[model samples]
Target chain A: MKRVLAVTAFTFRELIRSRLLFVWLISVIVLCGLDFLLSILSFGSTLQIFMDLGLAGMEISGLLVLLLGLAVTYTTEMDQKAIFLHLAKPLTRGEYLLGRILGFFLVNCLVVLGMGLVIVGLVVFLGGGTVPVLFYECVVFILLEMFVLTTLGLTYQMIATSMVGVVLYTFFTVFLGQCIGEVQWLLNQQLSHWVKVLLRVVYYILPNLEAFNLKDRLYDPNLVLGWAQWQDILLYAFSYSFVVFLIGWINLEKREFR
Target chain B: MERTAVVTDSPCAIQIRGLSKTYKTGFWFTPKVTHALKTVQLDVYENQAFGLMGLNGAGKTTLIKLVLGLLRPTAGSVAVLGGNISQRGVRQRIGYLPELPYFSKQHTGRELLGYFGSLHGLAGSALQHRVDEILDLVRMRSAAGLKVSGYSKGMLQRIGIGQALIGKPRLLICDEPMSGLDPVGYKEMRDIFIDLKKAGTTLFLNTHILDEVERVCDRVGILHEGVLKEVVPISKILESSVPVDYWIDVDGAEAAKLSGMPFQETVRNNGGVQVSGLVLAETLALLTARKAQVKGVRPLSSQVEAYFLKAIGAQAHLNRPIGGRRP
Candidate 1:
């Protein structure tokens, strides 16, 4: 446990010093600015459009931080061999993976939450609208989604030899995970039996990112986020994260640091 | 060409038997396996400064990584500190300084040590004191406050040693510890090795520096092409290599007589003379028998590099039957 905390703290500090947080701040500003401008240019309800884009802005910045975080750390840990100082010690491979995952999650949480607050403040003071309670719910779901992606990203870092390969694997996984819902709709179509089987397998295999896509349904009056729904979503996130974390741990143990 | 065992029954700090590593690359279906380390056997005992010498691509680093539990051995076992390398507590007791150590530039030397100390379950005052102690041991007390980016190559090496020493480990594995240091820096490192030895820390050093091995090591293990060629004591290697040449400063009157002797080179220097020869005792005895007053007798430097080269140089010593001779 102590080893995990130490790695967690050190990895967090490494991310901060790598200027990843600076990148996050810059992303928040640029993304929110782009959303604000696009909402005003559109003909629909500007306020609702802005809120929708703000949530989109949050997800974009959040995902961006995690993806970039994995790349930056992969370079430092593998290419630069900073991992020597850590893994050479008594810390177990599992603890090291867990700690790094936690570190990545914390940094991602900061990016999403920091942007959420800024957008909320902009809506209340300048956009002439009160921040809805549902917006916070969307933020919570976005946090959970970020958790899953971060774990998945780190899992790839364990298996991929090159930094570029790790990044590519993670980006493709995020794309497939985001497309699972649309593919589910296709699963119901009049496709061949084998195609449906393959689609069904892909749907079940990939994380159901749509389950945590609360931001897309924020304006839907029929949408509900009661205790039961929260339990299911959180349960799915934790179980999936646990499996990914285990895969990364086993790979790390098997890896030979040349 | 004979290799001698350390010849001690004491409990070993590190024990390896038939260790090998094969790295797999390429696509899953068509895999390429590179044999990084072949079957190698070595043993190092407590408080002994053992140096592992090898050239590039010679599996020196691979062996060290195996001991540190960073790489899994394909067909062997490694035990450190009377336990398996996989044992968690063994790592806490073993410090490592890797070749060309690179750390995060944002941390100061002190901060880096403190951070590593924390990983070893150190905290607060105990960690602080240990950090300070290692800093002083490596002579980095003044530079401890400076960021790692501001450090010179030598200072970086020192801090790398400092981090390794921070845990107060019983065994230290230093890989290529003297690869990039100047003369002064090497001297500093050499002194630290001696100090650590005196403090009862067993050291497992991997390097290509034969001079360093001669100076600081108790025993030396030469590895070539992923094979263990020989294990011999440093003191015996030095004792075995006959001095190539010896110089003697003699009196003026004895110069001409010394010049007439066979297998001796005599140079007239002012009123006196200096005689040189390949064998030290023969020349000294001849001079004394000839009634030449000997002013000084000094043996030349060591020939460790020669022995190391002869041991690992295309002799196929690794393929020779494993036999033991006393050093």
Candidate 2:
């Protein structure tokens, strides 16, 4: 556990020094600019628009940091062979992968939470409105979603041979993952047997990102925040992450540095 | 020539038998197979510096990786520290420095050392003390706080060696440790290796620099084209009567006497004759009997270099004439 944390801290320091937080700064400016413009143009409540845009900005910022971090680390650790020293140590390959996942997740957390605090501050101070309780729950859900994506991204890093390949694989997976609701809708419609089988395989394979997406239904009067829903989402997130982590660990163990 | 194992009393730090690595690349139907390492045998004893000498593509790096468990062998086994390298305890006792070591640019030298030390299970004040000691040993104390991105090549090599030693490993394996160092840095690194050897650290150095091998290594292995040609002690190579090239300086006034002489090659410009060690006496006698004034005689290559060339069957490729006949 100490060795894992050591790698985690080392990786975090590396990303921070690489100036990854600059993405958060740009995100805050854009989020505020978009919030103001959309609120002025829309006829709905201004606070609703503000909070909705803020949540979106947080997710987008987290994703940008993940993709960019993957590229940067792949160049140093893979292309430059910096991982030789780490693997040469007494640490196991699983520990290294876990540490890297935690490190990437930590950076993503900072970016997401930093943007969340900014939105909360604007709503309470400038708009003179109380923030909804669902906003906090949505933030937690976003963190869970980030954790799942972090595991998948690092798994792709292990399986990929090039930096571009890692980025593209994670990018397409995120896109398809977000379309789970539509795939479900397509399933309900009449379809060929073979096509339905393919859809079923993909649906079970890609992460059900729509499960953690509660921001869109923030104002729904029928929405219920219950213990059962939380349990299901949490279990799905962890189990999926564990499976992906195992795949990554196996790849790392079998990899040859030559 | 077949490889003759060195007879040593010390236990082997690394033991290899029938080890080979074959890489398969390209498409599946038409794969390209490269025999990087053949079925070779070697033993690196403890508490001694062993040098593996080879030309480019001679499988030196392949052999090192095989011993370290970085690459899975296609055939055979390697025992490091009397145990498998895959074991954590064995790895904890080993240290490795790659050729032209590269580290993440975002870390300071001190931070990097501390991190590696922690991986070796050192923590708290012990880790800090070890990091400090290594920094001082590598002569990078002043630059320890600076980021690695701002370091020079020599500074990087120092930190590389520092990390390798932070674990206090019993076996130190290095690939081209002297590469990219200035003369001063080279001497400092050599001094460090000598100190490590004195402190009871087994050194396995893979290098093309013959001088470094002669100065530091106790026994040397010559590898060529994926074959272990020979393993001999430095003292044996030094004492062997291997023929080396020599240059005899003569008086420029005797330039006329140099023509048509039975010497290898005569330099009329400097009134010098280059000859092999085999005919040095005969050539000097002829010069004396002819009343050609002899000024000085010097060897152009070291005995180790000549022996290495001869072991690889590359003597014919030497530029000097053989048996007093011009190539």
Candidate 3:
């Protein structure tokens, strides 16, 4: 556990010093700019628009940092062989993968929370309103999503032979993961048995990101905030992440650094 | 030197039997199998520097990676420090410096060392002290605060060695440890190896630097074409009757006296004549007798270089710009 923490700290320091926060800064500027523009153009309930846009900005910024972090670290660790030194240490491959996932998730948290703070500041100081409880819940959901994506991204890093491949795999997974709602809708529709089976497989395989898409349904009349839903979401996120993490660990163990 | 006397009796730091690696590449149906390491056997005992010498594609790095558990061997077992390398405790006793070692450019030398030290279970003040000692040992104290992205290749190599020694490992395995160093850095690295040897640390150096092997290694293993050809002591190679080339600098004013010399297989260049070690003495004697004013004589290659070429059956590669291969 100590060795895993060591690798975690090292990876965190590496990403921090790589100027990843600059992406957050850029996101903040873009978020503020878009908020200002949308405020002028929208018709009713500017607070709803503001919170929704702010939540989206936070999620986008978190994802941007994750993708960029994956690319940069992949070039250094896999392509340039920086991983050789780390693997040569007294750490297992599983520990290394876990540490890397935690480090990437930490950076994503910072970016997401940084954007959240900016949105909250805009709402409280400029708009003269109290922050909504759903806003905090949205941030937590975003964090859970980040955690799942972090594990999947690092798993792709383990399975990929090139930095471009890692990025592309993670990017497409994120895209398809967001379409879980549509896939669920298609499952209800009349379809061929073979196509349904393939879609069902993909549904169970890819992360149910739509479950964490709370920002889009914040104003839903029938949305429930019960502990049971929270329990299910958290359990699903962790269980899915655990499965992905295991695949990554197995691939890393079989990998030969030739 | 005393430890080297009993090196054969010492327990093996790394023991390999029937170790082989065949990489399968290309498509699955039409796969191309390249045997990276043939079924070979060798042992590196404790408290001695063992140099593995080979040409460009001679499986030296493959062997080192296999021993470190970075590569899975197709057909063998490696016992490092009398334990399986897969165990964390076994890895704790080993340090590996790959050829042209790279680190995350975001880290400074100190932070990198501190991180590696902490991985070895050093913490707090102990980790700091070890990092300081390693920085000083590798002579990177002043540059410790500089980010590795701004470091030169030699400085990177120094930090590479520093990180390898941070844990004070029982077995230090380095692939081309002296690469990318200036004359002074090279000397410092070589002296560090010598010092480590004296301190009873087992050194496994995969190097092409013949001078480093001659001055540091107790025994040298010559590998060729994924095969371990020979493993002989440096002392024996030095004592062996391998004929090395020599260059004798004769006076340029005695150009006319060099005309019909009775030396066998001697090539006269502009300022000197290159000859084998066998004819060096007789050529010098005849030159002196003719009053040709012999200036100086120097061996063209080290004994290890000659022995390596002879073992690989490539003695004709003698004049191919030594140091085994260009990295």
Highest-DockQ candidate: 3
What's the C-alpha lDDT at position B212 in model 3?
89
List the RMSD of every prediction in angstroms.
6.3, 3.4, 2.3
Model 2, span A9-65: residue lDDT tens: 999999988967786687679878898789778896988998998898888888889
Best by TM-score: 3
In Å, residue A148's CA in model 3 sits off its true spot by 0.3
Poorest 10 consecutive residues by lDDT, candidate 1 chain A: A11-20
Q: TM-score for each prediction?
A: 0.87, 0.95, 0.96
lDDT assessment of candidate 1: 0.83
Q: Distance (Å) between predicted and true CA of B164, model 3?
A: 0.6
Candidate 1 lDDT tens digits, A180-243: 8799899889999999999998988788888888888778888767899999999999999999
> Candidate 2 has which clashing residue pairs, if any?
none
Which 10-residue window in model 2 chain B sums to the lowest lDDT? B318-327
